[model samples]
Structure formats: structure tokens, C-alpha cells
Target: MPQVGSAHGGEPGLLTRVVEKVFRFVRLAEFEILFVLFFLIAFILFKDLMSRPQYNSIFVKKPDLDDRWP
Candidate 1:
């Protein structure tokens, strides 16, 4: 994807400013921060998925479906 503001020699976009500030906080270089952000978002998504309830149903009492029909 093209840089928000840096596209076609234009000024940087809002996205660029936000990303630049994030990288500054993390003490990472501009280029490196993009990679880090990608991994961080992926990790957060994975962690969130793993934290959800694993069971679907609480309990279900159903009659046997065997061939015991009369």
C-alpha cells in the first residue's frame, strides 16, 4: 500500500503521523515499527480467540435414537 501522505510526493497522511508516534513510543525505527505492529495485532487477535469459551452447549438431555421403537 502507498504511504498516506507520502503518496505521489504529497505530504504524509494522518495514518503516517499516528504510526510514527506509535513507533516512537516503542523505541523502534519507522520501517521496523510497521512489522512490529503487524505481529502485535496478530498476537492480540490470537490471544483474544484463545480466551473465549470453548464449550458450545451447557447441557442437553435427549432420548436415545436407537431402533427400540414400538
Candidate 2:
């Protein structure tokens, strides 16, 4: 079978290979930075909502005390 990749036999040199690897790494790092920022914003919003008294009241369960607790 004819070698497909060898047709262009001009394989990238070391510098090209290194630069491609660096760019790939930087692309992944960019996603990681965005991921961190997204979660950071979400956490801040959650914290702010929880800090408000109204938000806390929404989750509070009122206890039945007619004759259930005494």
C-alpha cells in the first residue's frame, strides 16, 4: 500500500512541532481559565443569594408544634 502521510514527506521540523504543541497546551489552558472563572462567578452569586435573609427563609421548614413536639 502507498504511504499516505509520506506523500508530502515534508514532515514538520522540531520548531514547528514544538510550536504546535505549545499552542495546543495554551488552548487547553484557556479553557481551564474560563472554567475556573465560570465557577467562581457561580459561587459568588450563590454566596450573595444565601447571604440575604429572604433567600434563607425560602428554604426554612416550619415545625408543627400543636402536640407533636410536647
Q: What's the number of clashes in each of the models?
A: 3, 0
- Model 2 over residues 1-70: C-alpha lDDT tens digits? 6656663466876788899999998897998988999999999999999999888878996676785664
Model 1 clash count equals: 3
Clash pairs, candidate 2, are none
Name the TM-score of candidate 1. Answer: 0.35
Clashing pairs in 1: 5-11, 5-12, 5-13
For 5-41, candidate 1 gives per-residue lDDT tens digits of 4555766778888998986877857567789899999
lDDT of 2 at 32: 91
